[model samples]
Target: MPDAVVVEGLSKRYGAVEAVRGVSFTVGHGEIFALLGPNGAGKTTTLEILEGFRTRDAGRVEVLGRDPGDRAEGRALRERIGLVLQDIAVEPYLTVRETIARDAGYYPSPRDVDEVIRLVGLAGQERRKVKALSGGQKRRLDLALGVIGDPSLLFLDEPTTGFDPSARRSAWQNVRDLRDAGTTIVLTTHYMDEAQALADRVAVISDGEIVAEGTPSTIGGRDIARARIRFALPDGCSVAELPVAGLPVDAVPAEAVPGDGLVTVETRKPTEALHELTGWALRHGMVLDRLTVDRPSLEDVYLRLTEHGAPEHNTRRSTR
Candidate 1:
């Protein structure tokens, strides 16, 4: 599929400091791509450059297949791209429907204000003043304004930052609806779970470069990361006394479990270990209390990538 956004060898600098250096990636059509990085890692710098809010120091960038740096082209691109910033400035006196309708006027062809308000779950509250809405409601209003223009691409920066669990989940469903309708989205969030849930693929940036890029499940070699199988120890028993062999597995040595009163098996082959362990327990009539298979989550891989800083080359793969 052709990319909706493309960047290569992108660089940006602020006087003596290099904010972004040699970062490159692509967002596929109708896909949700996330950019994640620790503070000062240049995630925003990269996004700003693509948005044409800042010019790149060096490298190529294309938004909707045209150079975003071109003033005339950029003006046209703005109509196709929607931005929901972290903070929204609005007249507290304006009602929900009024706010969206005002922003809709900027586009060549805007969506119906009523439909956008409904899509954003602000149906009954349309007449309520912006100042009267809750924090979550305000965020939804921001989302409505962003999509009111019916943009082909949407930029969501921490869309659910202050939302509660219920509000956050509601926001996730709205984002999914946009994707289903074929809107390419570029998201940036500090929430690892949000990135995993929404992004078709994610890129981790650090030290002004991309350190890893792949599906949320496999980035940073997470698929091959060792899994820790844990179970509570039976009374009066030591980890050594637990079954170690005589099955189709090479058990991780007992000492590696790392804690007392609970047995942990760290293995690269969790499937086989789990099968052998369960069989042994059944034969001995033992109950494996609190058994859990733990593997590397996106958060784990993200921490590892950021802490180590960027490598010579990013481990990038095709986006699903």
Candidate 2:
């Protein structure tokens, strides 16, 4: 089957700034694709272009097998696309059911309002006015309306932005269910864990261009198995005096001092380093305490990609 969405050398620019620069990627049918970046990274601009709300300055885009910039074609293509925006402003007096029913009218064929309500876990709140719902409930109502059309492609922009932990989990479950039912979902989120949990592929955009694109585990080439290890030192032993045989000298602080009667070390190879350090401490009659190992996360990858200009691999693309 052809891709659900495809772009080639896509670019978009405003008067003084380029909002999107030569960004290209494909979303396979039924795949959950995530676009992740900090604020002002052009994620929204890229999504807006694909959604036909904005036009590209250059390049080509095919969404649902139709050119998004063509109005007639775009309207037809939109029937198969659902959009859940980050901010939803609905009439405060409208009930949840009324809100969804109103949106369902726009699509030729829409899922049953009752089913959408159930799917989003808003069964009991169906009669509640929009103004009466909590923040999380309001978000769910937005999601319910977004999917009511039974769109094959769903655009979820920060779907769970204001949700608490439990509500976020509930929203994740709904997204997973949609994917299982063969919905092609394009998501934009600042929450790394959400991307890691829901996205089959992720593209990191910064300064109007794609800086990196890959699976959440491998984006920016992060090694998931590698860990950073830090440990506190014991009393009477200078950090410098701690035998640093196997540890990288630079990994240890130059002016390491006793903190709560312990020294600390950071290492990429935690398992090997910990074993060696433990053995050395045992041999030297010292105990290693407060040891902790942490793995690099998607947040780390996002920071690395955006903190600098485009990464080395992304340098070939022109910024403007």
Candidate 3:
């Protein structure tokens, strides 16, 4: 089957400012694709174009095998899609069941309203009025409404903004279930961890252009970047006393320094370095407290990729 969404050389302009410039990407069927960028970086503009809410100034864009820009096909296109936006107003006087059931009427093949409620964790609140719900509960209601139509493609814009940690995790599982059942998801969020956890692939946009795109683990060369292993310095040992001769000499520090009773080793070969370090400590009868290993995180890569005026030449479009 064709990809769920495809945009090539997409661009948009408002007044004299170009809001999006030559953005191109594809979302595979049943894949959770994340579009990430800082505010005013054209993320919303790009989404609007795809959602048929706004027209692009230039480019080829197709969503669910239909051109969202074509007015004649707009209704048909919308029928196949679902959207959970940041601000969607429901009647304050309407109960959760009434609100969801009302939206279910708009789609040709809507899911059962009660089933959607349960999916979004609002099973017990079906009788509650919309205004009576908490901020997080209301967000769950929005999710219920979004999926009530049984859409093939769902667009989630900061879907868990008001959710507590526990609620957020529950909602993440709901999204996963949708993908598993053959729904394509297009997600946009400022939470790097959310993107890392949910997205099959991610595209980072900066200054209206895609700067990098890849799986969460490999994006921005995170997979190959230096790893940092840290632990409390063993007592009675100076930084110089640690075994370092077998480690990557070029990347390993000449003098393993300790600060605040901790020593950190930066190396490209973490497995080898860690085994050597731990083995040496065991032989010396020393204990390494609070030990931890880490590589560059999604957030670390995001901040670096979105730096103002950061060159766009590093774009890593997915070849999958």
Best by TM-score: 3
Q: Candidate 2, TM-score vs. the true structure?
A: 0.87
lDDT per residue (tens digit) for residues 1-320 in model 1? 67999999999877877878898899998999999988678887787777777788899999889888888897799999998888878889999988888898899999999999888889999899999999889989989988998999998988997799988888999999999999999999999999999999999999898999999989998888888788887666677776687533545645524454567787888888888888878888888888899888899899988995542322111110
Superposition TM-score, candidate 1 onto the true structure: 0.90
Q: Write the per-residue lDDT of candidate 2 for residues 1-320, one digit (tens) a residue.
A: 99999989998777767777888999999999998876777777778888888888999999989998999897788788998887766788999999999989989999999999999989898899999999889889889878999999999988997898998999999999999999999998878999999999999888878889999888887764456665666667766676677775445433444455434555566666778778888998887677766767889878888995432221111110
Tens digits of per-residue lDDT, candidate 3, 182-221, equal: 9999999999989998999999999989999999999999
Q: Which 10-residue window in model 3 sums to the lowest lDDT?
A: 311-320
* TM accuracy, model 3: 0.91
Give me the candidate number with maximum lDDT: 3
Scored against the true structure, residue 306 in model 2 reaches a CA lDDT of 90
Model 3 C-alpha RMSD vs. true structure (Å) is 5.0
- Root-mean-square deviation per candidate: 5.1, 5.4, 5.0
Score each candidate by Cα lDDT.
0.85, 0.82, 0.89
**Stretches of model 2 off by over 4 angstroms after superposition:** 224-226, 248-268, 281-290, 308-320
Worst 10 residues of 2 by lDDT: 311-320
Q: How does candidate 3 score on lDDT?
A: 0.89
lDDT (C-alpha) at residue 232 in model 2: 68
Backbone clashes (count) for model 1: 0
